[model samples]
Every structure is written in structure tokens, then in C-alpha cells.
Target: MAGNFKMLAKTFYGFEPILAKELRDLGAGHVKEGVRNVTFEGDTGFMYKANLCLRTALKIFKPIATFKVLNEKELYQNVNRINWPKYFDCGKTFAIDTTMHSDVFNNSLFVSQKVKDALVDKFRAVERQRPNVNTHDPDVRINVHLYKNFCSVSLDSSGSSLHQRGYRIATNIAPINEVLAAGLLLSSGWDGETDFMDPMCGSGTFLIEAGMIACNIPANINRENYAFMHWNDYDDELHNKIVDASLNKTREFHYKIIGYDKAPSAVRKAQENVDNANLSEYISIERKDFFRTEKPIDAKLHMVFNPPYGERLQIDVEDFYSKIGDTLKQQYPDTNAWLITSNLEALKYVGLRPSRKIKTYNGKLESRLVKYEMYAGSKKAKFNPDGQEAKS
Candidate 1:
């Protein structure tokens, strides 16, 4: 059994608090949040569990070494000192990735090359052979982070991004990233207590992620592989136990999760993804323009989705957003509607003052997750009847 060690879970911008909370809830000790990341103390089993269950983390890194270095030669010497053979053998295909914020290193690619040379040299000297470099798909991934004069090396526990939850077989145009979808849902305070919806659900990512959250399903239940499985200290039995334990924690969801898409192709893709996730029992998809469809149920509804950003879709940005506001105001009452969009210029046309405007990102586009509280009657949108944003 491995002793407890400090690890970092990297997340998207503005999700550091969410990831930190998730880590703490999952029994991580000494949890602390950083910029787009959270550091915590956990043992090997906890590592497996974090990778298996965390919905917002893009990757989990187990730091092995930290060194002070001012020059490339020092960097090489420090990287060569690590006992690489104890982590992974020379036969394992590996890749070195670098991230830095330092005047000492200007080119990250060059830094990666230098680190790779040092690692390969160490292996060759010890075993008379070296691992092959596999950039596309590697059995082992080593990360080097340089901040100022300090360089930290870590082993990427999650092979691919945890967002690749292995259930999305089909994707519509501009399908939201799975991790982002889950984070947005969680940030919206979605707990599966009431009916849920994604009116413009693209490929059903929100629906599936919402279902998983509602039922307490592990976010990566369908994922079959991780980078930790290839390490020399991989423990299959412990990993199996972790998976089983997580599965046992899933609770039954009594509410409904519905998705609506106007496009037939998107509807098919969302259905395919839902089936792949084995969540068809909890989620249903329909083909209908959201502006034309009313709320699916008469209960309190929780809604989250990413609409066409006008970046890719050739729609009237103002009219589309206005229609969204109109639908929420007229069609969906007693609903908490949240949508993420990068078109800040167009968001003004919604004519409704969002109660909460959280800063987030959709890929490279800086976006906002705005919330529209549609009460049953007079407490609805803040839009004036003559189509003007009401004074706060």
C-alpha cells in the first residue's frame, strides 16, 4: 500500500472552488484551491477514485519531484535525478509535456525536448535502452511545470482528459465539452431534486451529465482506461475495489431529465449518446424548437445548456437570444434557466437581467453563465413589457 501524498486536480477557469469542494467531499485531506486547480492529500486508492468520480477535473497529477533551476542545464540535471524506472519501465512508450510561466524558459516545446532527453538518458544509462516517444498516444505521460525558477514534475494519472467519459459516440456541431457541461450543471446548484432540461441540448451531453449527477453515478464509469494502469506500481485489485465502491454509491433519481433539439441530426446524436451512457431510463430526447415548446413538466425545472454562439451558427443573434428570453418568460415558468454564451454583444438582447452572471469559458471563447429566474407569475424575468432591460 502507498502512503498518502499530495496531488493536484486541474480544472477549468472559475471551477477551482468546485473542484476543491469535490475533492474534499471525496475524502481528500488538506484540500486547497489554486488557479484552475486544486491540491489535496490522498493515497493510491483515492487517486483512482478521483479519476473515476470527479466530473470537473480535466486531469489529476501526482507530483514526484520539485526542484529549483535557473537554466536548461540545471533543469536537465534535476529531471535526470528522478528514479524513473520505479514509476515506469523503459519499455513503456512515454511523452513529456511542459507548461511554464517563467522568463527562464520561453519555448515550452524546447523545454519538453530537453526534459525528454534527460529522461531518455537516465533510462539508457540504467537499462541500456530507452522508451519510445509516443506523442499521439503514450502509455505514460510525464508533465513538467515551470513557475519562475522552480520546476515540478508530475505523472498524469488520468490518461486522456476525464471529459472523454467514453459514452459520447456521436457529436453535433459545437458539442459542449463534458467536463464543462458537468461543471456548469454543478455550479448551477443542480442536485437532481427536480425536473431538468436542456432545451438546446447538443448531443445530449448536458442530459447525460445531469443524469449522472442526479443518480450519483461516477462521471467516468464508462471510461475503460487511465494512465495509472500502465505504471509499474499499478494495482488492479485496488482499482477494481475503488470502481465497485463508487458504483455502489450511486443513488436513484426520482426526477426527469429531458433534452430538446430542433435539428433532427442533433436529436439522433443526443439519443445515441444517451444510450451509450446507459442512461436512457432517466433521460429522454425530443425534436422541437425550444421557443415553440413549453416546459416538459409542471414542477420546478432546472435548466442548463449552451446555445448557438453565433460564432458557428448563422442565426440572427439578437433575435435568437430574444426568443430565448421570450420562451423563458412566457413558456417556462417556475424554472431556473442557465445558459453559457460567448456572444456578449447578443446577450444584451435577451431583455432579461440575469440574477447571476458567472464568468466561465467555452473552449477559447470567454463566456458567461447567466441565470434567468422565471417565477410562476410576477417574479419572472426582469424584462419590461416594451422590450427593455429593467432597472435593477
Candidate 2:
């Protein structure tokens, strides 16, 4: 508790609660959920752990300054007042990202330009040299957020978004994001209690993430980079200690994580990704159409997948969803199936009303994560047309 500071973990929409729970479980203090982010208290070592372990976090930011700004001049002066040289060296490349939700600034780009000018001017006046801007891949990333005239400037600790978990080397046409996959699994209450399956696993993101969660493995175990690594006060020894501590917490997972893909190419790519993540021991991939195969295990199964939303894949959306419903009803008994899709109209054809429908986003497209329950014996004996259970 010597150097405890507040940190914010950004996540996708509707993932605030799940991300908050993840932070709390990781021993964060005073964890609070915001719109699409979570705020918590942690020290420098904990920050490294959060960056390396939080599966739902997009980026972890350490806020250095907060103020009320009435105009552009005030923003520049306030940002310039901070000791920019203390955070990073002049030789390191940096990038400024601005997000505005206020009428005071019509263009976010203009705000970013002003902030950059202030930072560079501060560095030039103090250190006699300015850090060059590298928008493509920066060593340092700064975030400026404005909401209703209030400005919060933070230093981004995680670069390139935490979704780039480094395990997914091969990608399919529209592979689900690793963060999104992990969030969905957590949202579905997956605790490694039973066997897991991703019937239409593309690039095996869900399988890899599920395996990590099951085994308590650090989310970024395969990741090699973080913006904090370029900071002036980066302590390699502290970071390594944190990594070893997290690795020491790893537990054994007894269940299987299975993936199936109809396309041979997708199966190969998913297997490659699984191997890349070093999860091949827990996850097994096969080239088999999900609709044609019954449940591989008789015990209760947990399923989460992103079926082709008919975006890049050539298929009849309505018929495909119908077959999905039919197959789940006819084959996969005693299973809980969840899928996310942006095609709402096509989703209606699934016939079985979802027991739960959560509004979420897949990238920029608004989507729904729905759950369908398959009974063990007779499907009609338990589920009604409305997705509710039938009376005894």
C-alpha cells in the first residue's frame, strides 16, 4: 500500500460488471464500475498484474491529472502544467488519443493537437528535446477524455489494446475478439465447473481464453509488450516478480475444452492458435459440422460460440439459425448454449426463445448474447415455446 493509486480499466459496452468482478477477484481495492470501464486502487506491481491478467480490460490507464476546462487555452495550460518529462524520456515515441463528449470542443482531433503541442512544448522547454509522435505503434500512449467540460488526462499502461493477447496468430474471416470472447464466457457464469465447447470456433479464441480462465493463467502470458515497459521508472525486477507471483497462482483444470469447425481451414487455423497459446493440452479442435454431430459428452456441457452472422460467410442466415435451433433441440441435451449475433432478424428464426438476451456490441455492430437451455431427455418436457420451463 505504499504507492497505491487509482487506475481505470476500459472495456466494451455491457462488460462493466464482469470487468469489475474480475478486478475484485484479482485483489483490487475499492473496485467500481463505470459505463464501459472500471476504477480500482492498486500499486505499481498490481498495475502490472492487471495488465497481464485482466481478460476483459481493453487498456489500463493511470490518471495523473483531472481539472475543469472552459476553453482550449485552459486545456493546454493545465496539460502543460503536468511534468510530462517525468513519465517518459524524450527519445521514446508517443501518441495522444482524445475522446470528447462535450459541446466545448467540436473536434476531438483539435483537442489532441492542442494536448500534443502542450506536451511537446513542455518537454522542449524542460529537457530541450521533444518526443516524436508515432501513431502507428507508440512507445508511450496518452489518453485525454472530456465529459461536460471536465477533463481527465491519463497515461495508458497497456498498449495496442489488451485484446491483442498475442496468442491469436491466425485469424478467420471474422474472428471474435479475445476480450469479447473472455467477457462472454464470464458473463455466462463459466467457472470451469463443466466441459466447455465452442461449436463454431473460429481461430479458437474462446477455447484459448476459456482454458486460461479455467487454469487461472495470466491473460497476457503470451504478450510481449506493454506501454509501461517504455516508461522512465519501469522496474523490470518488480514486473518479473509480479509475473512469477501470478504464474504461481495457476491451478489445475480437469475438464476438456473442445472446438469444432465445419471448414477444414478454420479447424486448422483454430488448432494453430490453440497451439500458439500453449493450450493444445486442454483444448482439442476437430473439423466437423456442429449441426451434424451430437453432444460429444453425456454430462452437462457449457457452450459459447459466435456462429457465422452471415457477414463474411456465404450462407442463408434464416436457415442457418433454424438449423442451429433444430440441432440444439434434437442433439445437444443437458446443455446451455450461448451465442452472440448482430443479425437480429435472422436470430428470430432460431424458434426457441432465448431464456436470457443481453445487449452487447461486437466491434461497432450492436449485438445480442442469448442463452438457450437444452434439456436432457425430451426437449418438449422442459422448455416451452417462450423459453420458459413447462409446469409439472
Candidate 3:
């Protein structure tokens, strides 16, 4: 606890609690869940581990300064007070990202511009040289957040986004984000206890993420870049040590992790991604129509997928959803099926009541992650006299 400091992990709307649990499990202190983010205390090594191990985090930030401001001048002065030269060199390009929810500052762009000016001004006054702004792809990313009259400035430790896990070299037309896929799998209570599946896998995002989770593998193990790596005080030896320590924590996965995509191209891409992640040993990708296929094995299966919502793929909504319902009820016995879709009206045509319905968002559209429990033989007779689920 000598050098432990507060850090924040940014996540999706319904994933704060999951991220908080991840932080706590990773030995973080003072873990607290906030809206779309989780705050915790850790040292520099812990920061590296958090960025590498956290599955649901989009970005990890280290707060540098916090102050109260009412206007642009106050914001500029407060930002300028920080020692910018100590964080990154002037040779490295930097970018400022500002998010504001205040009456005084109405425009986020204006706020970012002011902050950028302050940073460049301070560097020029002290070092006589300014770090050029690289909005496209900056080596250093600075985060500015304003709530009411309070402003907090932090260094974005993770560049781009943690969802770019580096294993997914190939992708389909409408591929699900890696972080969202991982969050959905975690939300569905997948623990590698049973056979896992994604009937509508696109580019194998869910399958790879599922395999990684099932094996206790780090989320960003394949990733080679981070904003912190570009900082002046970055410790390569400590980072490598953390990486090795995290890798040593991985456990074996016995059950199968399978994926299905009807499209031939999707199957190839998914297989390519699975191999890229070195998860081919634990996962299988096949080109098969899910509606025409039954469960691969005679065991309880954990299923999660994101089917078309009648928006992109031209298909009959009613017929497709009805077929999905019929297949699960008639073929997939002793299984827990979960799917997320924005087509709420189409979801009703499935004709099966969801055991659990959770409100979630997919990118910008509102969606629901619903679960359907398929019994072995009959709903009332879930267990036979032998205390086992009756199989047809």
C-alpha cells in the first residue's frame, strides 16, 4: 500500500458491478462502482494488470488533478497548474478528450481545445517546446471530465480501447465488440462448467472471449500497446513481470467451447480469429445452420448469441424467431439459452417466455439480454425419481 493510488476503469452501462468484481478479484483496494465506470486503488503494477486482465473495461485512467472551475479561464489555469512535462515528452504527440455535464461549459470540443492550449502553453513556458496534437492517433491521451462545477483530469492509460484485443484480425460485416461479447458471456453466468456455444457467431468474438474467460486468461494478453507504455515513467521490466505473473494464473478448461456460423466466410474468419488467439485447442468453429442442427452433445449447454434484428440481414422476422423458438423447445433439451437483440417486437414471436430479461445496450440501440430455460422432457418433470433431469 506504499504507492497505491486511485484509478478508474470505464465500462458499459450494466457492467460496472462486473468490472468492480473483476477489480476486487485482482486485489484492488477501495473498489467502488460508478455509472459506466469503476473506481479502485492500486499501484503502477496493479494498473498494468488491470488493463491486461479486465474483460469489461474499455479504458483505464489514472487521475492526475481535480479542481473546481466555473469558467474557461479557471479551467485553463487549473489544467496549466499540472506538470505536463513530467508525464510525457514534447516529442510525443498528445490529444485531449473532454466530456462535460455542466451549465458553464456547453461544448466538449471547446473544453478540449482549452485544455490542449493550457497543456501546450505550460510545456512551452517551461521547456520552450510544445507537443503537437495528434487527434487521429495520439501517443498520449488525456481525459477531461466536468460534472457541475468540478473538473477532473486524468491520463488515459489504455489507448484506442481495450476491446481491440489484437487477436481478432478478421471480422465480419456486423461483428460484436470484444468487450460487449465478454460482458454478455459473463452476464449469462458462463463459468466454463458446461459446454459453451454461440450459434450465430460472427468473426468468433464471443467464442474467443468465452475461451479466454473459461481458461482464466487475461483479456488483453494479445494486445501489445497501451497509452501508459508511452509515458516517461513507464517501467518495461515491471510490465513484463506483471504479464508473466498474470499468464501464470491461467487454468485449464475441460469442456468444449463451440461456435456456429452458417455463412462460409464467417466460419473461415472465426476460425482464423480463434487460431490467432491460440484458442483453437479449446474452441471449435463450424459452418452449420443453427436452425437445422440439434445440440452437439447430450449434456447441459450454456448458449449465447446475437442474431440479426431484421435491420441488416433481409429476413422474415416472424418466421425466423418462430423457428428459433421451435428448435430450442424441440431439439435443445437440458440447456440454458441466452440471446441479445434490439428487435423486441420480433422477440415476442419466439412464443417462449424468458426466465430472465435484462435491459442492455448494443452500441447505440437499446437491447435485451433474455434467457430461456429448455427442460429435458417436461417442465414439471425437470428431475426424475433418480434426481436427474429426464432426457427425451
Candidate 4:
């Protein structure tokens, strides 16, 4: 507890509780949930572990300093007082990102500029040379969040977004974010309990993430770097030990994880990504239109996918949705299918009343994760096409 510091893990909206649960499970102390973020206590080593292991976190930030500032001068002074030399060297590159909800700082760029100036000034004063600022790819990334009069300065432990899982080399036009993919799968209560399928598997994110969850694999086992590796106090041996320990905890998964994509390119990309993630043993990708393929496995199948939303892909939204519904209703019996889309108007064409519909945001678009339950065998079922019960 002596070295433990408060940390925040940023996430998407409606994912705070899920992230909090993850932090608590990973032995974080005093875990608390905020809007689109979760705060917890951990040490430097745990920071590295969190960056490596957390599946739902977009970024992990370690707050180095907090202060009260009413104006720009105070902001600069507060940031300058920190011991910058203790964090990185003058030869290292750095970048600053700022977010503010305060009236004092009108522009986030100005705040970032001030923080950068303070850091460069400190380095110049001590070593006579400042760390070069590299906004594109920095050795160190700093985050400043100003709310009202409170300013919090944090070092970004995850250099890039955790969504860059190091496995996805090929992507389709509208590939889903890895964090969102993992979160959506978890939200659907997918613990690899049974056979899993992604009917419209683009890039196979869901299939790979599901395999990792099923096997208890570390989320970033394939990732080669983290921002903490550049820190002065980073312990390579300790980090390696943590990696070994996390890998040792991996469990056996005995269920089938399959993916199908209509586009041949998508299937190729998905297969390539699955191989890159080292999950080829657990997953299989096929080039077949979901509407034309029948259920491969007879056992209970859990499905999650994002079809062409008509936003970019030129397709008849209503007819495509109707075909999806027809495929599920006629072919995919004994399955719980879940899909997410921003096209609310076209959702009606699905025909089946969603058992559950939850409003969520995918980036700036308002989206819904809807679920439909198709019972197994001999059970007479009918889809309501009157469009009466489908609620937003």
C-alpha cells in the first residue's frame, strides 16, 4: 500500500460498471466508478499489469499530480513544480493531451501547450536540453484533465489506445473497435459457456476476443510495448514475471468459436487476424454469407455481430435486415443472436421482436444492442411484422 497510487481507466459510455468489476477482480483497491471512467488504487507494477491485462479499458492513466488553478499562470506553475526529470530523460520524446470542463481554460490546445512548455522548461533547466515534443509517436504521453478549478495531471500508461491489440493488421470499411467488441461480448453474458458464432464477422474481432476470454488469456499478450517501459522506475524483470504469471493463469476452453463473412476479403482478413492473435486453434473463419449458411453446430449457439448498417455499404437496409431475420428464424434455431447498429429505422425490418434492447453509444452515433431468442426444434414460432412492440 505504501507505493500504491490512484489511477483511472477510461472507457466508453455504459461500460463504467463493467470496467470497475474488472479492476476489482484484478485486485485493485478502493475501486470506484465514474461516468465513462473508473478510479482505483494500484502500484507501478499493477499499472503495467493493468495495461497488459485489461480487456475493456481504452487507456490507463496514472495521475502524478493534482492542483487547484483559477488561471493559466497557476496552471503553468502547478505543472512546472512536478519533478519531470524523475519520469523521463531529456533525450526521450513526449506528448501532451488536455481535456477541460472549466471556464478558465477556454481551449484544450492552450492547456496542452502550457503543460508541454512547463515540462520542456524543467528538462532544459536541469539537463540544459529539453525532451523533444513528438505529437505523433511520443516516448511519454501526459494527460491533463481540468474540471471546474481542479486540475489532474496523469502519465498515460497505455501509450496507444488498448484497442490497438496488435493483432488486427487487416480491417474492413467499418471494423469495430476492439474494446467495444470485447465489452459487447461480455455484456451478452458470453463466458464461452457454449458454441459461439459471429455471423457477419468483419475482421473477426469478436471471435478472437471470445477465444481470449474463454482461455483466460491476457488481453495484450501480443502487445510488445507500453508507455511504462519508458519510465525511469519501470522494472523489466517484474513486468516479465507478471506476464508469466498472467499467462500461467490461462484455462482450457472446450467450445467451438466460429465466424462467417459474406465478403471474401473480410474472411481473409479475419483469418489473418485470428492467426496473428495466435487464436487459430480455437477459431475458424469461413467465406459464406450468413443469410445462406445454416447453423454449423447443433448445440446452443451464442451470436453477436454487426451487419452492414447502410451508412457506408450500399445495400437495401430493410431487405438486408429482413433477410437476416429470415435466416435466424428459419435456420438459426436454438440460438441467442445479438447485433448492434445505428440504423434505427432499418431495425424494424428485422421482423423478430428483440427480447432485450439497450440504448448505447458507438462513438458519436446512438446505437442499440438488440437481442433475439430463437427457440430450438419443433417449437412453433412466428415473427411479428406489424412493427408494434419494437421499442427504442
lDDT of each: 0.93, 0.93, 0.93, 0.90
Off by over 4 Å in 1: 378-392
- RMSD of each candidate relative to the true structure: 3.8, 3.9, 3.2, 4.5
Candidate 3: pairs in clash: none
Error of 1 at 380 (Å): 12
- Measured with C-alpha atoms, the lDDT of residue 269 in candidate 2 is 92
lDDT of 2 at 286: 93
Clashes of each: 0, 0, 0, 0
Return whichever of 2 and 4 wins on lDDT. 2
lDDT tens per residue, model 3, 26-60: 99999999999999999999999999999999999
In angstroms, how far off is 378's CA in candidate 4? Answer: 5.2
Per residue, candidate 4 scores C-alpha lDDT tens digits across 1-392 of 23899999999998888898889989999999999899999997788889989989999999989999998899889999999999888878999989889968789998999998988888888889888989999999999999999999999989999989899999999889999988888888899889999988988999999999999899999999888889888899989999999999999989999999878999999999999999999999888888788899789999999887888787999899999899998888899999999999888999999999877777788899999998887233444598454422
Report how far off residue 125 is in candidate 1 (Å). Answer: 1.4
What TM-score would each prediction reach against the true structure? 0.95, 0.95, 0.95, 0.95
Error of 2 at 75 (Å): 1.7
Against the true structure, candidate 2 reaches a TM-score of 0.95
Candidate 1 lowest-lDDT run of ten? 375-384
lDDT of 3 at 145: 95
Pairs of colliding residues, candidate 2: none
Ten contiguous residues minimizing lDDT sum, candidate 2 = 375-384
